[model samples]
Target: MKFERSEENIGNRVFKGALFVAGGRFVLRLFSLVNLVVLGRLLAPEDYGVASLAIVVIGFMQVLSDMRVNSALIAMREIDERHIDTGFTINMLRGLLIAALLFIFAGPIADYMNEPKLEDVLRVISVVLIFDGARNPAFTMYQRNIDFSKEFRRRVAATILGSIAAIVFAVLTKSYWAIVAGTLFGRFTEAAFSYWKIPYKPRISFREWKVFVSFGGWLTLSGILSYFTQTIPQLLIGKYLGASPLGYFTIGRDVAQVATRELTGPLVVAITPGLSAIAHNTQRLRTAYRKAQAVILGIAMPIGVGTALMAKELIAVLVGAKWLPATDVIVWLGPTLAFTMIASATDGLAMAKMATRAMFNRALFVAVVSTPVFGLAIWQGDMITVVYALVFRMFLQTAVNMYFAKTLIGDSFFSPFTSSWRSLIAAAAMAAIVSAVPASFTPSDPEYVVLLEMMPRVLLGAAVYVLAHFVLWRLAGRPDGFETKMLEVSGIALGKLRRFRRTAN
Candidate 1:
């Protein structure tokens, strides 16, 4: 409820804020699952292919134009209205220009892909940029203050409204247009609700242009290279491999990335303010960075391992038989996405210290190296090879990122492994149990039967993971780490529940 930052309960606020934002993202993911399931049944793989091409173009433009000023604002210790106004004005101008270019260039991009229908889709999705850019700058204020309950409401409302629009359109048209409609509606609703959540208006100003540019210049280069590293492969697939294959890859990649991203995004966002506040304290920063990375990876590793183990049944249950080819995507990309998030913690550390050139160099190296490697995969005509290539590229990048973190935090290169050793062992155990469990159904079995087969594996895997994780932690003498922190919190929660129950009785 408070817009001003408070020093009291800093730790509590960080956890609470992360949970609120994570809760909102979790709900959004549920809505997206509904869309994927229903639309997968209604539309063909080719529909996702066409939609993906358009999305790639729009995604590139957003990366090109984004100064990441909200990040700058959050990381900066001192700022005024001038910085806020400047960020808004830049976004507004960028949005208008990018939208115009997209509308004008849709034909050429589609022509390049040899998909004429893609032109209309690209043109329609361009409006999303305008809505995104015009969103209220006040939203950042809540984030900077580590308050997120109000933002959660806006997200929930937008998700419900946009999802309903998407499902209704899918039922009526049953085409790619339904996908376009949902995206456009979601961005519009989010932008509209931004103002309703806060009572602040921004003005057009460039008084703090130098400040933002200093913070974002290297980040811009880094973002552009990062976008290409991911997008080049996609565009190549669409052009060389074919639209249907592109559809499978896109759906698979998104599924893996979205679930992992939603899991890690809260800590990534909430930690920036905390990190920035102590940027000058190297000892504290090192400890915090190691522990935070440990906590995040500890939570993510098991989920990734489980998803890979159950990729076949998950694909069959969610997208049906025609999408079975995408199963390889889920298999490799699941672990890749999880590790990618673990590596991303290093980027936040760099940003907090205002040393973004390291990030830029890292992105440049990955992009330069990955582009040709991915191209070679496509030339081999094995899309499955591309998935393998993707895993290699990401893991290599993650190592590079860890090296950078070592430079920043004075930790060893293999600190990540050391920080989360318990998690690693537990995940391995979970994977072994799940994979050793015999399949209950053949590939030709009905979806319900496959679903039944997957459920028990999921449950058993989850149980083994938790039990193994705690036992390993206990065997280690309950060292002061994330596991101990988690158990203490659980105990506090249980005590509160008991007291509340007694009062109710």
Candidate 2:
């Protein structure tokens, strides 16, 4: 009975945490949509592309600097002030080193890409490295304690301020410098807030140097490999396709990443702490994995498919005809986006099991496979061909990552895929229905007409898909059963609350 009560408490906590993360993500995404729309119009594609070149180098260096130690700090059990301080000190040093390197390499990087203008942009963005590195490691303490309320506030504030700064600078200067400046400002603000909110100060001590380096070594390698897997395409494009075409490619990638990051990121952040808490309990780990997979797939598969189907209309309507070329890129990359989302969830499973070496090796494989494929595509000298290469590479990488994750978790590689197949099918049907309804409703004003026509189709499609999911779950004998379990858990939580209230009385 005590065990049952404890299980109920765990379920309740998980439910609440998931709700907060999901809600926060939705709000943040809305803000991001606004930011993208404003920036897309305000800046030229060439400007964005130039900024992208600089960002690629800055991003790679930043990843190497941080080394995922902040995540490791949250994952560790029995963390102390000493651990927090050590992680903080390491992050600060790494950030300073990275900033210095970026400043030194700025000219060379710009010259390699043959964009002399990018030199200044690279130098300016280097400031973010130091700022981001100096952010308090104690910020993860909130996450480690499952206090997402603070996390949400901190992120939203940073995003809002950042978006505003970017838009303002873009309007004032009409240059890529605006984007880079906004990013630096946002990072600085976020880092300052993190330190202010978290109650920890760093002392200059490398007392735990051996332990920190040992763990961070594997994490840093994983970070570098992951950076290569993600950024190699941008590098290849900037090298071969020049700025404008790279801009188009970057737009497609960013659109897909926005969905992937916003939808899956919060879940990743929320799940790690829970998984860490249950790392030793195989049964609990399995339970969490199953539910997390189901929830992520239920949403991600439909989103990816729908985005693919609606890419042309959506981009034409939202970003204007200037972005219509991104439509093909979006469709080609959609499945990759979905698979990557699933892979992210699986990454949590690997981390929970402390399989950093396995994770590193898988990432390395992806980087190796993706880089040459990207280079080949660049050699082909076509934007669409480059996107196709990305699609193929991402698909292969996702499969490999998923296999490694399943091996670590003692599950079949196909388990998540099989579970999600139904949802994917339902979403496809919904997309078809939505697409058909909008065909006959075209009007003279393309944007307004598209929005008006799409509104009802979207509503109907969402309703049908959700209803179908529930019906299918019921027919499979899982509907009421899952809900009943939840209710039972909630009832146990209420009973405990009542007991506490009575004691206080």
**Judged by lDDT against the true structure, how good is candidate 1?**
0.83
For candidate 1, lDDT tens digit of each residue in 207-311?
A: 999888888889998999988887876788888888899999987886666577787788777877777767788888887787788778877887788777877
C-alpha lDDT score of every prediction, in listed order: 0.83, 0.73
Who wins the lDDT comparison? Answer: 1
Error of 1 at 421 (Å): 1.1
What local lDDT does model 2 show for residue 291? 68
Off by over 4 Å in 1: 1-8, 443-446
| TM value for model 1 | 0.96
RMSD of each candidate? Answer: 1.8, 4.9
Give model 1 RMSD, 1 decimal. 1.8
Candidate 2, position 100, lDDT? 92
Candidate 2 lDDT tens digits, 364-426: 888877778777787888888888887888788778977886787787888766566557667
lDDT of 2: 0.73
TM-score of every candidate relative to the true structure:
0.96, 0.90
Query: Could you tell me which residue pairs clash in candidate 1?
Result: none
lDDT score at residue 117, model 2, on the 0-100 scale: 88
